[model samples]
Target chain A: MGQTNNDERTPTLLDDMFSVANKRDQAALARLFDHFVPRIRAFCLTAQPGSNLMADDIAQEVLIRIWNKAHTYNPESASLNTWVFTIARNARIDYLRKNGRYQTGIDPDFLWADDEDENADPFREAQQKRDQDTIRASLKQLPSDQRQVLAKVYLEGKTHKETSEELNIPLGTIKSRVRLALNKLTVIIRR
Target chain B: MIRYHPSIELLTEYSSGSLSLAKAVAVSAHLEHCKECRTQAHKLELVGAELFSDPAIPTSDQQLNQLKTNLLSKITNGEIESSFDKYGQAAPSVRMSKLQSGRPLSSESKYQIPKSLRQLIPSFYDDLKWMSLSPAVKIATLSNEKDGTQVALTRIKAGAFIPSHTHTGDEFTLVLEGAFSDESGVYKKGDFISRDARHKHKPVVTKDAECICLTVTEAPIEFTGWFTRLLNPILRKHHPSTS
Candidate 1:
């Protein structure tokens, strides 16, 4: 878990995001770019190794979206990291869909919209912060096997079935590993 | 009040952007009606965010600087392409209504098609080209994925019974309007029902109103009754799998 640098840098990144949104500050945008672009590129490369051209295009597209959709970002509902991560993910999906990989008419924009809950108050905000911290700390404690599956699914953009095949494990094992990982992270709330 | 939901693993995939678009559309429809699931999904996204922000993989400084310069120049040139402009003005507000409302829109003066499916269903579900399967059942295809998955809307007449059928593969049905009941239990608006090949039952719509459902079928379902069996060839032909 690369927590130390992020934990220190996140506050400034949040401020930079606010400046970009409220003042359209290019300086702040540049700062945000210097921070997130490499990470976004890395995320794309993880999913499509050796596809640097696609990576560059998606990374640039994601930064532009951040510049455009900054006003819509709500820190109460999501961290800046989470917000930017979603934008990057959607951009990657959009790129793949348009490049004839997915070949479906379904738009990724509608499938993943910001769930702006009207009832977001300080209590929930505090609860969300706690959840984020818990996930960060608990993620480190997860066994490597479970963590590998999670990384495959989240970073590599592999479905469970794909992960199963890639890892030479049964589909049931992949599902259970995911379940066990989420359980450790307390991400699954029993209904 | 929504009960049935996508399993946590499915929600995780949806949040991580790993689920196929067709199945993700079904989950999105369910989220429009289930705040609990929405909250769950949001939590899973936090996990994705944490993983996504893992220490940056280094890139060559020259390449990074070039991309940044290009992006900044574009911004200075006012060349940003706003998603709102491209996708239509209604996109953002549609997302608002979808997240804010938990109850099914069936009670409204008009049925509000879920925003996820609005790409296929423009104004009204009635506008789609519907083909009658029988006197009581009709279906309009929304999309056919390359992998043989079929996304369609099934409109069952009021108080009518669909012939008993078993799926050839997995089937996901989300009730869009009214209610329907099979041997298992009654399903109302916003309820997601997943049936595999093992399930074979007759569903009867409530007598009050016609029931409309958004169904994603992995393969064409097979009817069990002797008379309805004749329709299998037609169904297989229409399905992306056999076609």
Candidate 2:
């Protein structure tokens, strides 16, 4: 896979930017950085205890990744957002790992290959993503506490214990939050 | 650590994004072959997305676009995504089917029992006579052996109260429907409440909906009170193996 290092757009345009980036579209790259940079910097700035100067550096690094790997974008396989968030999730994990705060990495084999088995048919992946989209829409109905637990544990890569500590709640509470979140989520998604 | 079926919990976590990439990939592969967990995972994923929008963030259309761009660029080509064969989901054979058939009583006519649970019975468990516990509950005498161990499906009415009793042996309850409440707490669909000999309580299904649970037990219930004790013999005669 190719690699690039460019900086110009903001983070808000991430999804669109990725679609264009996948096509090796340079104009979209410009729009991409212009939209995402500030937010990325802000996120890094707030998330880290002592890091405002390096926020720009991290944000720049994240953008370069977008530019070089655009060809690998597979809309039929994964949504632009899921793909991006996955990237961000990994990057955040990488940052934490370097700081000894987290341990996670994306595998080289899993990201690019589309698993297009002739016998299995690859189109099912698209259908799966669509089904997931509907389920995600339903999860939006849950109350905030359950939502937050899911976000921190699932999205932010925090452990239940870590989440408990971070949220200043009990361990059992985390389990129940997850359970309730999932239960309510299942009900909504099935509909 | 709490022993949970990796596919079930990991799929739940993957859909929620709680699982690591290394792990989620494996779970994804398991999902490829296992339809039950895949459906559940998809449902969980939908729930995660639903929760995302619930938070009222002040992201203007412009900011939202920026966030998306930043995310896309991060993983465009950093590393090769792992293949399913190399790092497939870690699903022990024991838990896979127990985890898969989450429905109370599967509507699917062909009941393919997992090897782990299947090993418990002789060849004839499948052929056992199944009877209704109530409108919701169904019971089957898997073993007519002297020990009297059997497997049954208890489909409780939405608001039904299971006579509070104590288990004489290991009692495994896997939820197939709405939710159930015991002295412990409420258990929703897909939640597996496995109580060893130590647990004893009355399970009451909430008014929200009925609960159907697939329960496996070594011995029959020790009915708590005088009336319940009197009813025990009647219950015993109804079971194929006990009778």
Candidate 3:
């Protein structure tokens, strides 16, 4: 139903969606929404706990943003999934910042241009797929203690202090676990 | 030149969408000026994105199509800007208290404000209306910040001294130009200064040049000594900022 699945990271469908949206192709956008919305909704729910309403709100915002910022998507720079999920991450941050409190808004220079490797590999998608597989594998390799700390802090939106209190562990130990986990993850991602 | 920067924790919070808008604004401004922090923030956001895209999270079908409807309405109505055209979404409200009472007195000096600031408020010195809080300090207020927060631009003349004061809540000061010194340390352009109730110090402008700063406070100042405390009421009277 999607791109060549030699690697799931191939953004073939995403590429078509963005190019079509750039041309104001409504049908293409509708297709994109039907395919991606469920995934984004699920992702948002996992990222933020106990806020199904907030998760839905974030999914809506992510779609609107993707529709509006379609031209900004550089396929050469990142996979479409990474780009869409990036917007979801920022929207979640906005949800946490505002926290049911509405205000006008703030300046939006949040995204930065990352240095994409120009290694002339024809199989960029396959490479990215491999990278994704490696990243998830690395996630599994993390000690349960470290993964637990990260899941609480990054996914559940708990401060280290709250997580410490919840686990009845010292805050310093929790911080150390997160640090070690980040180092291990970075080494794996770079590999 | 950005010797001072927000901690990684703050940057992570900024990326996670959990920071208050005031803090978000300050972080945004700093990220615009500092490339290091910008890269750090991007990496952190990527990590968050990776965490979310694991494909194992559970989702619902309820109200799935409603989002598409909302988006289609905006796209069809010409409310949103297309890639071929520019979109300028005016903030719904700018009825800030300080905007009505007074405009800060901007100097004829040629210090250019950060270009990114124009996104939040007007930046040209002529357009800027700075109201003098003291002989040397002026504050140009911006939005009607919700949650009792105050967002404003402050300009301090060279060698002028800001009064020693503590805050009712968190105070964030980002140096946009020049430098200043308090009991804490010296701050230059791109330095993000944060203080709370436990910290009290008077920031004096560096001898070389006047300093321009963007300050967001959760509440108004509580002047420490008798003199500035007496001035506090007048400060509040003339400059009715939420912070």
Candidate 4:
């Protein structure tokens, strides 16, 4: 991915990630902490409102996971934000599964295991960057209703059914809105 | 090649981590074989990340410092060190090798369990406590969710026929081994077939090989045949819904 002049933080985070992975640098870990912990906390709080303890616990867990799994991060396969977002997402699911109403024996780690292809090539890397940029740019143009559904699913951790119930819209409408939004983002190309 | 795939809605929910664990298990198994769905799910994850990196909620400077201090102190005190050591020692590769070494030598040894299910099935499918639902059909319960969903594996003898049945709720079946044909179509390994209460059909395994499927049911299925109808109570009792 080309480093645009305005997006300096990407390279910095990439460097910090490498340092943490290769050298076990606590300073780099601290930098990562400052960058990701707040975002992770916000992500968790969006799912469980008024539960700062839950948010804090999940944030810490994600950071610790980043520390532990830093070496597995591959910039070519996914952006650092994407990598960390998944970690945060899985951490939230695990936290809920353990302590919240959604108790289950199923382990999130195996379900969402990092299965990125090991055979990375420059062509694949460019394609990934293009896809990432398209998604980021098109996401801004999605209509408010469509964007709302995406937010509910991705940010608030609501299933389509829950989103429908919470928004007082029909479940079919929720599914269609998600479909339309994903189509606009070109995230789900029909085969 | 895999034919039937999870719907876009299911893929989106699975990618966003909004789908329940039992349902996600079915999707994960399909992705293990269907590269197309895997690509779609990966793209969906990119969307999640883009939204995830939106402007933060702005924690207070004091709270941020306190959190960072707490984390650093734990790191400094070598608490994370001990945990890291434990993780490194018990790495998944090592455990996987250990499990492989313990598998019994047999013809079925070539059957590779899907990675998503290895957590529940340590080595082999034969190791599970398969209970006979009929002479030709046996099922081993894998997990029962608190929401009354049932995840299990159904093993059918070669050329065997499963009695016509209808679902009480949504049922997701991922073909794990061999192939089975129902009124809808033939489903082979990696094919994900989702059936709801409206569908009632019998499935027959291909004569060449026995069929094994990973099934996740939101509610127990009901058999339509009079003799098999008697089996509904047994199915319900085993399912978390009735009990």
Docking class for candidate 4: medium
Query: B137-175 in candidate 1: lDDT tens per residue?
Result: 999999999988999999998999899999989889999
What C-alpha lDDT, on a 0 to 100 scale, does residue B128 get in candidate 4? 88
| Model 1 steric clash total | 0
lDDT of 2 at B227: 72
For residues B111-139, what per-residue lDDT tens digits would candidate 3 score against the true structure? 54454465555435446777887888888
lDDT by residue (B12-40, candidate 4, tens digit) is 99988999999998999899898888888
Q: C-alpha displacement of A93 in model 3, angstroms?
A: 6.5
Rank list by TM-score: 4, 1, 3, 2
Q: Using DockQ as the measure, which candidate wins?
A: 1
- The C-alpha stretches of model 2 lying farther than 4 A from their native spots are A1-23, A34-50, A53-58, A103-140, A187-191, B1-4, B7-243
Compared with the real two-chain complex, what DockQ does model 2 have? 0.13
lDDT (CA) per prediction: 0.84, 0.51, 0.65, 0.84
Model 1, runs deviating above 4 Å: A1-7, A115-117, B56-62, B80-89, B92-109
Candidate 2's displacement at residue B188, Å, is 28
Q: Model 3: residues >4 Å from true position, as ranges? A: A1-6, A11-35, A44-71, A90-100, A104-138, A142-184, A187-191, B58-109, B123-129, B234-243
Candidate DockQ values, in order, are: 0.61, 0.13, 0.27, 0.56
Question: RMSD per prediction, one decimal?
Answer: 4.3, 14.7, 6.8, 3.0
